[model samples]
Structures are given as structure tokens and as C-alpha cells.
Target: MEILRGTVAANAKPTKPSFVSYVTPEEIKSESPRPYTPKTVKCPHLLPGEVMFCSANTVVKETQDDLSQRGVFGTLLCTNFRVSFVSDEEPTEDTTQLFKNKLYGQNDIPLSCVDHIYGGYEDKRKLITTGSLVKNKCPSKLIFHCKDLRVFTFVLTYSEEKDAKMIFQGIVHHCLEPKSLKNLFAFSYCENTACPEKQRKQRTMMFDCAEDWDLDMKRSRGVCRLVTENNNFELSPDLPQFFIVPTHVTEADMCQFHGKGLPMWCWSHHSGCALFKTSTLPLLPEDTIAQAYMEKMLTAVAHNYLFSVKTEDLSDTLPTVQDIQLAYSKFKHFFLIDNTTDFWMSDMKWFSSLDSCGWLDIIRQCLQKALEVVECLETENTNVLITEESGSDLCCVISSLVQLMLDPFYRTLPGFQSLVQKEWVAGGHNFLDRCNQLHLKDKENTSPVFLLFLECVWQLLHQHAPAFQFSETYLTVLSDSIHVPVFSTFLFNTHHHRATVLRAESPHSQRDPLNCPTVWDWSVQFDCRAQDLFLNPLYTEKPKHVKSVQRSRPTHQRQLSLPTACKTPPKKGFFKDEADSLKKMLRVKRISRWMLSPETPHPSSATREFYETWQRKPLDHHGLILPCLDGPSVRVWLQRYLRWIQEVQIFGGGAVTVLGKVSELQGEVRELQRRLERHGGSSFSSSNQQQQRAIRARTGTSTGPQTGGSRSSVRMSSSFPFTTLKHNWSYKPAIPTSVLQSLMASGNLADKEDDADPESIV
Candidate 1:
């Protein structure tokens, strides 16, 4: 290596090579520069008139699955319409999603859907109600429990203290404590120009006007006459302006109790019997005057042409509204799980816990009551008069259920909507109070009566899937729609209340609330493709030629007639011995005639004939359908309750799979029909036959197992795609005896060993 020396001495000063500078040193050193302006946060898309009140950066935890979760950094926004979370990391579109909702995004929860809010601080979580939030500081974590059985968690640990507090208070005030009905997002949405006109693929009878009610009366072939006595709501606020009562019931009968205890016609059976619902009479002295009025009102209802009325006191037979509230409160807790640990912990004893909740038991009781009313109408040929504290609650439930089972028309999608309109909306159920739409915190008034009705309907749909034109998905979505305030269908307590709200002008704006949309217009939420999921492909329509037969009335009243008594045995041989022999002879005679038919056909021959005719009918969808009330038959609606639980979801299972298979088969059938038409009844060519054979082979062939003696055996394995061989099946062991024993001993499964391996022992 060679050493080199610099041209100048090391001690000499160096000169700087200068270039032009854009800013001077004085300008750069200025203490007061342009006022700092923070970049604006991009909010998620809002509804037409939805206004964002506050927002904060939050780490959203994936609570869908408990075992593993990744936090998504997003801005949590509180809008008038909903609580939305916007994340840059989330994909804009999911190709795998089969059902897409236009009204709500995956992270969007409607303000009305917010059933309960919880705050977490220092590892402890407490309910964040309006009253509690007033004095409490903002929490580091926030959780939302929704009416649709959805749970969301947001972490505010990384957010600014002020931002977190602002967002927390905003959500609490807007969601849990709305001041009036006008404040609901629905009114705002109606005012916006973006809100579209009511669009419906199918015609749904709203029963909002007299024409709809008249059409229903004509369709049911009802004998009752419609009255406009309450046209201006001068008679009763709870009743619709236009309603049909028994023909003999006069305006004076309706005036009593303000339409209470007035039997209103629900539907007419083909047998000339009808269903009626009335509210209970006011408490009065058990004197002659009260009794006289009650007798006169009931007499008018019973005297209706061709109706022998049987009064059913629903309050005495069915579970009370308070009981339903308590049961549902306990039942919903099992589903509102925050983490995998809590989910698994609850899953272990889900059945027993569900039973203890009493919800399913209530469902069973409601079904049994409906069946009793059905029996009276179908077999006894007597009209039913259902009375309750408020005819709107259980009365609507049983009436709707009766129509579903008795009238095939109600099983159809349009008819189902019409039934809800007729019995619930037109009947004036207090949906606003019962659903807690205003977030009033009135525990006594808030109950899941409508939810209970839906659950009952689910049972019927599950047991008789093909009987209904609508799918379980329809019911599930309809249940969620109740919490969405955009629907005027369930927003008000009475018809008059709805009318007043709709016609009333806003003081703050010139918008008309009358334009508020109804839930029946499904296009407001889902497009045609998405709406197709609501129709069941398996439903077979009733044959037009088939009609319910009207049987003639019996000449004499039927009574329990005992077998003709045999002649008293004559005193024979010596006293006691002769008596024993005579008794034995009498017993023999009764046993011999037991197998023989009655000398005269029983007076219930009409009932038996009707039942036999129903059984012989090719279509079971239109005729009477009795629900199986056995314990095993009353099942949890898994589609509605567990749809969000990722672990419980089957990868390639559920109704979607069945629907796909059905569609494929239908396509094949159509293709074959077209080919046959093209061939003009000629046989297929050899090549065509070969192609068909190949198609069949790919689809798999089904063969019936051969019978060997009394039993017909099923093959253990098949060529079907879903069929699995016995050896290929995997066995999952039950919970270890020690864990169960620990649970029994300690009354808590959490006390068991955490490290215990399930497969190792049990």
C-alpha cells in the first residue's frame, strides 16, 4: 500500500461549496407557522341522511371465533343510522359470501339493533346503560350486544383518551336513549332523496287500508261484515280503523270497554266455523249489570250464522308475557358469547341450560294451545273465541298459527305477510313498547312476544319444511328487520299511533314521515338474487281443483253412549258359586263384542270422514297439519341462533347445499324435456344414450337395499357424494368423567383441570 499526502496542509481552513436555499434561516426558525390542520378521517358509507356524530381509531377484535383472533385497526364511527367500523385492511368484496345485505355491512350495527352496551376497564366489564354512563368515565374497551344475536368488541387502549370518551358517549346517547320516535333514523331516511320508492317482487297485502281488508274477507269467504265505526279512531285507539266483527255484534258492543270483549273475526274455516280474538273486559263488580253486558256480547258472537262458539281464555292457558321476558333474557345469554372460552364453557351444558331457560317449554305450551283450538274448529266444528289481557299478544300468536296449520294460503310467502299484517299490525300489537324501540328501559313492557311467535312458526316450518313457501332464512331476516327502525311495520304501538306519526310534520324540517317504508318491500334491503334465498324450492303448491269438503251437521247431539247392558244373570245353582259363573259369562260377552264395530256409526262419523279425506288427499300442504309436540321434536332453531358461530358451521352442509343439489336436478330435468321435444318423441341416438350414461355415472347411482326377512337393510356405503363408509367416520369422545364429576361437585365446569386432554381419557 502506498501513502498519499493532501494538496493543502491539514491545519488550513476548508471553504464551503454553496447552493441556492429555498427558505431563509429566519423563516425556518419562525415560532408561529401555518396553523396545523389534521387530515380528516374517511368515514364508512352512510345512509341517505345518516350523520356521523363521532369517531375514534380502535382495534377491533374478531370475536366470531374464540380460539384464534387478529385485531383489525379501524375507525369506529357512530352514525345516526348505525355503528360502523371502517378498516383499510378488510377486503372490499368477499367472493365466497353467498348472501349479501345492501342495507348493512359486516361491521355495521343499526342503532336500533343495539340491545345492550358493555364497557371494560381494568379487566372488569360492566353494563353501560344511559344512567350508568352519565357518571362513568370512558372505558378502554367497548362491547355491543345486538338484538340480532350479534356481538362486537372494540379496543380503545391505543386511542386518545378524549376520542375514546367521545365515541363511547356518542354511541350510548344515540343508541340506548333516543328521546322520541321522530329521532329514529327511519324518518331521516325517508326525507333523503336517496331513499327509493317501495319496491316488491311479490304483492304483499299491507292491510293499511280498507281495500286490503275487504280483499282478505272475500278470499276467506267470511260471513262477518266490515265496520268503519272506528274510521277516525273514535271508538278505540288500540283497534284498526277498519275491522270485521261477528255479523250480529253491533256498534254498541264495540263501544263497551273501548272495543275490548268485542269478538273480532280472524278467519273463517271451510266448515263454517270461524276464529275470533277479543281483549279481556275491565274489572268490575260481579253484579247483574256486568254479567248482563258480558252475556249479551258473547250471545251476539255465538249467534253468528253457522258458528257454535267455544271461548278459549289464552291468558289462562299460555305463558304470561313476564314469563316470556324472563326466559328469553336467560336464553339469549348463552348465544351472546364474547370469546371461544366462554362459548365452549357454555356449549358443554347447552341443552340443560336451554331447558332451564323455559323458552322452549313456552313454545311447546303455545303449540299445544293452538292445537286445542284447531281440534275444536276441524273436528268439533265449533268456532273459537280467543280472549287475553290484550288481544294483541298471545292472541295474535295462536291466531296466526291456527291459520298456518288450517289454511294452506297462509303458508305461502305473500299470505304469510298478509297474515302478519292482519293479525299483528291491523290487530294493534304494542310493538314499539314490546321491542323497546325508544330504549325506555321499561322492563315490564319489554318482552319478546313477537320473537316467541317466530320461534313457534320455526318449529312448524322445521317439522313440515315443504308445507311452507318461505324458507328459514326468510324468518331469520324478518326477525332482524324488527330491530331495524327503517320499517314502519313494527315501529308503532297501534294503527292510530302509526297514522299520526306518518302524517305529522317535523318541526325541525319539512320532510314527510308518511313516506317511511314498510318492511314488506324487501327490495329496500336485498336485491332479487338475494331475495330468492327466502323462497323454499321444496314447497309444492296446493292443487286448484282440490277443495275442503263441507260435511252435513249431525241430526242429534253426540254423547258418550255406554254399551247396551246385558240381562241380569238369573239366580243359579247355590248363591255365591252361581254369582261367580254369571260374572265370568258377562266378561266373556263384553270381550267378544270389543272387536266388533258399533251397531250404528258413531255421531263423529263426519269428523272421521273429514280426517280420512284429508289423509287421502295427494297434497298434504293444503290440509290440516298437526305439529309433533314431543320433547325431541321441539328443537332449537339452529339456523337463526348459531348462524354467526364459525365453529358450528359445516363447510359444505346446511340448506344451501340441498338447494344447490335441487337446482342442479331441476336443470337436468329441463334439459331432458327440451331434448325430448326436439326429438319429436323419437328415441335418443346411441351417442346420446352413452352421454346420458356418463352423466348418470358422474352424478352417482342410487340403489335400494335388498330386504332379507322382516327388515330392509340399508347399505353401509354408497356411490352418493355425501355418503360415507362406516370405517371412514371419526369418533369424538364425550367430556371426561372427571370433568363432569368436577362440574357436578363444584357446580362450575371452569374448576376442572385446564390441561386435561379430551382424547386421552373418557
Candidate 2:
């Protein structure tokens, strides 16, 4: 007690919360001075101020520091289905009980449901003792939160002579049925010290994503009940959800949907996820031939990688997070190495899975073929087969490419042990630039079908990695820029790209006025009888339309097809809205609350392109109800201002864009006419004409190819367009600032030649 007290600031009273003063003992050093906090909601073993109840001599903040020979992470599997048989109402209770006892493992014994337990153990002193029974008295079930937003009830008793801890692994990754535990969701956080920029971004993103997702869920579930009683920011303590969702329906609706529905306001806004790049691989046009095999082939692919992907690493028989991260890392490297082995160069189960037994050889062959031009990647390669038919068998190319792009970034996430040496970030970005370069230099060496594989790989990396380097700059400004749409277009322009996860602040002026509600309208509001809530009464009448539409025609389509080059999309919710009027009637709930002084929406750089900033200064609040008005009509002055800004942002951009195009056309016309006079055999008179003729004659003479030509001879570069260039300067140059200042004596800071890298161009 004395030791803990002495560490506190000398002037501070003991009554203060530990956070205001240093509570960590001086003898122990923290991992990082900055003391980073996770922005995203996460449940690490030792969150700040968390304490494990103990009657020991002393307890240390670090669980590992206090315990001896303990695992940092743990897993425990529950095998007590018989415990639930008391629910006589469930008819399956008997069958479920028999099924539980009948369960068998690989050896086919009537196995114990809980075969193993994972957690930390302290062998030195049995700290958890009830009446000195030592470890034997430890409770098998201690309640705590999990990173995956789950609270499980474990029933196990500990028996250790010394103090011990059971490490709780983030997720349950054992038993074939564990995959069903996904009504639970997870998010990311930084375990790293805060000073690292990468960690900072990741931590912030995790929190922001969580917050935004929660808002979406609340809004969608019903008109969200987020408004505080008196405009308080302190969220209502009674908010029902623990984990964030895209949107959430109300409790009754949630129970009805098996506790699932996009959380209101939790719209990732993915319905119209802006296309950064068009998919080069369009949806395979419908055909009876491909449709018949599509499911079977897709099943084969999913089965080929038969291992279950856990949300987090469990410590039992299942592989750890570190292992999965490593496997992902390997998957990325496969893209870089030209002659990398096929079996398991990237994915751990690549060549080892039961279904992949015969597929590896075929994939290797595909890789060899993929390295050739677009035509060669097809099953029947011919120079003329450049259409979709040519590259019909594209799965192998996709698989290999996925390996190359994804593995490296996935290696950077929290559970993975690989240290992202500070120097590697630039190298990672350059990898993509380099790929573009190689592809341009030798078009036949790689093709877009393979690039789709690269995109798939990136998709995996984005999913697993904590930090995605979507943007970079030397200084002045930084943007969360994905220019993914740009790179993706180069892959294939056939299918719509689904990299639909991005949110950033943009200017308020840029948002779509229509999208902004004048009022914070609720998602739905209805009240009749709370008792018959879950039942759908309308199912009694079956619609005749379903009977007539048994065949596989595109369910509903626009009367006309789009241009052959792009897809034709129906501009409404393509997914069945369910049109459940009875469900809708039962679910409409009212606005829980509204603040008279509503707050301004936070600005986002990325989402602002179609975002509108709304504030309720006075009239817009539309208190309780307005006479004969659906929404309050603003006085003439403000209404005009709102319309003006909205129209300018949405329509002004179009005008400026059109003006710029016209100017460009004018400049091009003048340049072309000048070129015609100089090279298009235009007859001219006078001395200027004579000079022009001489230039034309020289151009004609130099038109033929020259051997061993100098760069001054003006030959077109063979490399394709837009690949990044690498400079190979002969001399190491001194900084211009240093040279100029020194040479100027009484001083000027300016380059003698041109300012190569403009720090301030203006």
C-alpha cells in the first residue's frame, strides 16, 4: 500500500480517480510513455483501471508480470448441452440432449465437450483462494467482456497450488459449430504505444467506425432513440445494443429478425457505394451452361480452403491469430516472387487442403499461362480470343493473384507478431507502383485477370490489416485517399467493384441537399399492441405472382439493355424490400426524443461529396407539430440560402467542369492547326514558308528508323502509359537550399536551374 501511494503525485489526494495521477508503481516501466488508448471498443485483458479481485499479498497491473508460466491468450470450449434440457417447451430438447451425449471426435469416442482449456497460470503462489483451498477454490465461471462483444457463462473449477490466470482468447475457434457464434461481431484496436502514427490512425479508425456503425444501427432499427433528454451528449445509458451494427431495428424487430437487421442510421451508405473503379470482370452473363456449374464450382473453391476463419485466435487445438496472420503475410509475398512454389508459398492450406489435392498442379499451370497476354489466360488461347470468351476459365488466375496482393498487409494486424519496421510502409506502397511498372514494360507478362487476383489479395489485406496506407504525402496536407477506383479500373471494367468501405470528412457544401432531412425523421413509428409483436399476420395470403415466376430470368429488368460496354442497373432497391406491410405495421415506432438545440453533424472528408450540413437554428426544429405542414417551411431568406448552396455544390461543379472542357477543346484545335502547317504538307509562301518546308523535309528524312540512336533523336518510349518512373542519377546531389544559401553569401535561396521538387510552387 505504501509503494502504490508513493507513486502518486505528491499534492494529490487519495480520493481522486487513479487516471488523474500516476498510479503505476515506480519500479515497473510501462511499454510506452505515451500510454496509447484504443479508439475502437475493445476488451483487452488489462484495460485501464481494470482489476482482478484477489486476496493475495499484492497484485500487479500486468497480469503476466504477476503470474508465473502463464499463457497470454486462452480458449475454453463448453460441452454442457444437457444443462439446457430443462426447457421442456422446446421439443428438440430431448433430441438435443441425446445429440450432445452422442457427439464424437476424430477418434469416435463419446468425447467430453470441453476437451481443453486455455488461460494463464501462476505456479509460484496460489493467489485465488477461498479459505486457503488454493487453486481448487477458483471459480470456473468468472464473468467478463470479450473483444468479440460476447459474454459467455463458463462452468469450470480451477485446481492449482500456485496463483494462476486463464488467458481468455478473443474468440472461440474450435468445434465445427463455433462458426454459428457470429451473431456476435468484432472490431480492432491498438496494443501498440500511441506515438507510432500507424497505431494512432488504426486506433482512431476503429473507434470512428464503431461509433458510426452504432449510429447507423440505431437510426435504421427504428427512428433512433439517441436524442438526449436535454441535448446531452452522454448517450442514454439504457441503449439496448452492446456491439455496434450497420443499423439496428428496435428490440421487438430485432427479436423477430433473430436479433439482426441493419442497424438504423448504420448504413455504411454502401447501397450506392461510389465506384472507384469498374470491375474488369463483369458478372458472367446468365447461361444455363455456366449457371448449372456455378454453385458446384463455388462450393469446391470454398471447400478447398476448409479451415474455419476465427474472429480471433483461440488457444486450444485451433491455430492462433499469430499463425493466421503469418499465413496472410505469405499470401501477399506470392505476388512478388515470380517463381514462387505453388503448394504453400502464400496460403497455409493452399496446397495442403483435402479439396486442393489435385488443384495445385492445375493452379501452377494457370500461373504459367497467366504470365502471358490476356488471350493465354483462357482455356482456349488464341490471338483473336480477347473477349470474355477467351478468358472464361478465370478462377485459377484469381486465386493466385489473391495470394500475391493480400498476405503482406494482413501480416501487420495486432495478433500477428511480425514487427512492421518503420521503413516498410513506403516499400509496401511502392509494391503496387512497381507492379504497374512491370505490367506496362511487358504487357504480355501480366494481364488484368491476374490483377483481379491482386485486388482480391488487397481486399484480404484491408480486411485483416489494422492500417491501410490509402494515402501518403511529404507534408502540408494528408488525405485518407484510396485512389483505388483508379487502379481498379486498370484491372477490368466489367463488374462493379465492392471495396465499399470508406468514410472521410468532406466540406459541408458538397453534400446532397436531398439526402439531408430537414427534420431528424425516425426510420419507422407504430404502436398498436406490444403483445403480438413478432407474428406476421399477412403470410395467410400468398401472392400469385410468385407462382408465375419460377424460371431464372433476371427477376426484373429495364426495358432496354445498357450500352454493350457497361451494365444496366435497375435504379431501385434490387433486393426484395420484402414489402411486408403487416411487418411494417407492427414495427412502426415513434421518435423517442429530440433536442431543441440539436447539434451539428460531424464533417467527413470522403463522404462529403454527397453530404449536406443541417442545423436547426430555430424554425427548422418544427416543434411537436406545425399547422397543415409535413415539414416546417423556412422563411423566404434562409430557404433561398439553403437552395443556393445546394444547387451550387451539385450543379456549379458541372458548369465549371463544362467550361474547363471547352477551353481544352479550343487549345487542342489551335495546336492541331499549327502541327498541320509544320508537318501536314501545307504550302506556305515567304521566308517563314521556306523554313517550315526545310523543317518538314528534315522530319521526312528522319522518319526512317535509325540504328543505335541517341535519346535526342526522339523515339517514342516503349513502356505503356502512367507507370511510375524510377530515377537513376549518376551523382549524389547536395540540397539546393544548402548550396544556394552558402553560395549567395549575403544570401538568396533559389535554384540556378529549375526547382526540381517544389516545396512551395507558387
RMSD of 1: 13.5
> If scored against the real structure, what TM-score would every candidate get?
0.76, 0.18
RMSD list, candidates in order: 13.5, 31.5
Reference-based lDDT, each prediction: 0.70, 0.22
lDDT of 1 by residue, 17-37 (tens): 587778423224446677654
Per-residue lDDT of model 2, residues 116-211, tens digit only: 222223333222212223324344333322111112232223312122222222112221122221111110111111212224322222211235
Clashes of each: 1, 61
lDDT assessment of candidate 2? 0.22
State the displacement of the C-alpha of residue 706, model 2, in Å, after optimal TM-score superposition: 52
